[model samples]
Target chain A: MKYVNLVVIFSLLTFFACTSSDSDYQVSDIPGGYMPGDTARDFQLKNVNGKMVSLANYENAKGYIVIFTCNTCPYAAMYEERIIELHKKFADKGYPVIAINPNDESEEPGDSYDEMIVQAKEKGYRFPYVQDKTQEITKAYGATNTPHVYVLNKDRKVVYIGSIDNNARDAESADKFYVEDAIKALENNKTPEISKTKAIGCTIKWAS
Target chain B: MIKPMKNVNLVVVFSILTFAACTSSDGDYQGSGTAGKHVVGDTARDFQSEKVIKFPELQEYITTSTDDKVKVINFWATWCAPCIKELPFIDSLRYTYDPDKVEVLLVSLDFPDQLSKVNKLLQRKKLSSTVWLLDESDPNLYIDKVDPSWTGALPATLLVRNSTDQRIFLGKELTKAELETHINKLLN
Candidate 1:
C-alpha cells in the first residue's frame, strides 16, 4: 500500500511539472544569452582611439558596463546621450561604460570604424568606442539588439542584461533606469531585483 | 495481477504520451467560417488607413479576431534592413492565401515621429496588408507581454489562432518557405 501511494505521488508530481513548464516556457530561457549570475568572458577589441580595450585592462575597476551599439541605428542614437550620462555618473563610482560597435561596415557602411570615430568625436564620448571587427564577442555575449547592455562585476559576472532604460523614444520621459538601478544594486552589494529585461533594438547586422 | 506500483507507473507513462499526442495535433484543426475575403483593390489606398495604437489596443487586436482568421502579426521597423527585405514575403501572404483564413497584420515598430517614413516605404513597396505602429513608449513593458521568448529583436512574428489555442512566436527573420510552412501548419 505504501509503495502504491508513493508511486501515485511521484506520477502526480511529474504530471504537474510537465504542464507548468509547458505553460510558462519563455523563449529567453533557451540556451545562449546571459542570465543574471552568469559570469561573462572578457573580450579584446580595438577602440576608436587606436588603442585595444579589454576588461583585463581595468585593474582598479569595481565592474564594467559593456554595451553593444553601433552608428546608424536610430534606437542606438537615441540612447547615445544617456549612455554618455551613465559613464559620467558611474565611471567615477567604479563602473565605466565600454561601448562596442558590432555591426559590419560592409553591411552598414555608416557603422565602419571611421564613422564610429566620427560619432564619438562629434558626441564627445568619454568612453571607449570599440569595434567588434570579427563579431565573435557579439556572438559570445548573445546580443541580438544594438544598444544592448551587460552590467558585470569585477569578477566579470553578468549582473544585469538588457536595455539602457525603460523609454527608448524620449530619454527625458523615462521613469525607470534599468542600468543605473543595476549599478546601484551592485554598489550596495545587493543583487538587483530585476536582473533581465528586453527592449526593441536593431538586429545586430551580421556580415554577409 | 500486476503490482500496484507497476500499474501506477504504467498509468503515468500512458497519461504523458496521451498529453503529448493531444497537444501535437492542437494546431491542426479546420478553421471555421469564411470572413477573410480581402477586396482586391488599390494597395496604397488600403494602407493609407494605418494608425498608431497602444500596447493594450494591440493586445485586443491580436486576441479578438474579426473573422476567426489566423493572426500573422509581424513586428518590423522601416530601418531594419532584413525586415524591409522580408516585407514583400509577408505581404505576399495577404493576396496568396484566403483572406477568410489568414489575416496578415504588419505591425511596424517605428517611432511615432517616423510615421511618414513608414508610409513612404509601405507605399513604395506596395504592401497591401493592414499595418499599425505600436505606440508603446517603453519596450520593456510590452516586449515580454507579446511573448516571453522574444528578445525584443526586430522582424519578430506572432502567429496565433486563439480559438484553437495556437500561438507560434518566431523571433528571427524568416524565409518565404518557412512562413508558408508555418501558415500551412496553423491552417491544416
Candidate 2:
C-alpha cells in the first residue's frame, strides 16, 4: 500500500512538472505547439457578451479563423480592423472569426475582460470576441505574439498558422493575404500554397 | 511486489531524465531554415538606417574591424513596453565600456511612418547609442532574413564579434549583468 502511494505521488509530480509553465525558454522553444496540418483542440472560452463560445456551436462553419490577440498590444490594435474585415469576408463562406485575448490582466490591465468588452463595443465587433482567461487554449495553440492566427479546417486540422498578412504596418499595402489565401484554398478543396509565415508582434503578457 | 517497486523506481528515473532534457534542450531547437542561413557565425544582415543604406555599403557598416570589440545589436520598437523598460540598461552599455572595446546599436523595428515616435523615445531616453529605424516594409521577408531563430519578437538582441565571426542571439530582454557576461565571453 505504501509503495502504491509512492508510485502514484511520483507520477503526479512528474506530470505537473512537465505541464507547469517554463517561461525561461524563447517562444519558439515551447514544445508541443500546434503546427500546420496538426489537429487543433476545441475550447469553450468566454466571449465579451458573457456567453461561452465554442467552435462546436458553429455547425455550418466550414472552418474557423482562431486568432490569439489582445487589446493592449499595438500590433493587435493595428490588425483589429483587418480581423473584422476577415470575418466579413469569410463568415458567410462558412469560416467565422473567433478572437481570443491571451494576455493576463495583472500584466496588462488594458487587456482585462472589461476592457475587451469596451473595445468590442467601440469597434462594433461583428464576431465573437472572447477572452482566454485561463490561457489553456492559448498555450495549447502555442501563440507567442499578439494577432497570431491559426486557420483550422472543418476537420479541426490547422491549415495555416501565421500573421493575417505580410504587412502589419499597413493593411492597404499588404501584398500577401495569408489567411484569405488559405481559406480560399480550402473553399476550392485545394491545399494552400503557403502554410506558415512570421511577423514582428508584441509578446503575449503571460502571467508570471 | 518487489518487481513492481523496481519498475516504479525506473519510471521515476526516466521521468527525471526527460524533464532535464526538456529544460536544457534550448540548443536543440534549431531554425527550420536552409543550412548556413542567418545562423550564428554567419554575417548578420544590415539594419535599415535613417539614410536608407543599401547592401555592400551597409555590409561595411555592420562589420567592424577585427579589433576584438563586441558589437551589440538590439531590435526594439517604441510601442513595446518591455523593450522600453530595458532600454536604459542597454543604453548604459555605451557608457559602461570604452568605444574601442564595445559598441551598442539600437535598431528600431517601428514602421517607417512611425519614425517620429521612435525619435521621441530616443530623445526622452537620451540614448547615446546609434539608432536606426528598419527601412524594410514586410516582416515576413525581414524576420527570417535577420535570424532564422527569431520569431519576430521585440527585445531580441544579437551580440557579434566581427574578428572571430562569433555571434550569440538572445531572444529575450536581458539584465545588465547577463548582457555583460555575454559580451565578456565574446571579448575573451
Which of the numbered candidates is closest to the native, going by highest TM-score?
1
Q: Model 1 chain A, poorest ten-residue lDDT window?
A: A1-10
lDDT for model 2 comes to 0.75
Q: What is the TM-score of each candidate against the true structure?
A: 0.80, 0.77
* Model 1 C-alpha lDDT per residue in residues A1-208, reported as the tens digit of each score: 0112324433554565577522223433223656678899898899999999999999889999999998888788878889999999999988999999999899889999999999999999999999999988888887888889999999999999889889887788888888999999999998887787788988888887
DockQ of 2: 0.23
Q: What is the lDDT of residue B184 in candidate 1?
A: 74
Candidate 1 segments whose C-alpha is farther than 4 A from its true place: A1-31, B1-42, B65-68
**Model 2, residue pairs in steric clash:** none
lDDT of 2 by residue, A1-208 (tens): 0112324433554564477422122324454678788899999999999999999999999999999988888888888899999999999999999999999898889999999999999999999989998878888998878889999999899999889998876788899999999999999988789888887888878787
Give me the candidate number with maximum lDDT.
Answer: 1
Residues B91-165 of candidate 1: C-alpha lDDT, one tens digit per residue: 989777998898888898876656556755775676768888887888877886787667888889988887766
lDDT of each: 0.78, 0.75
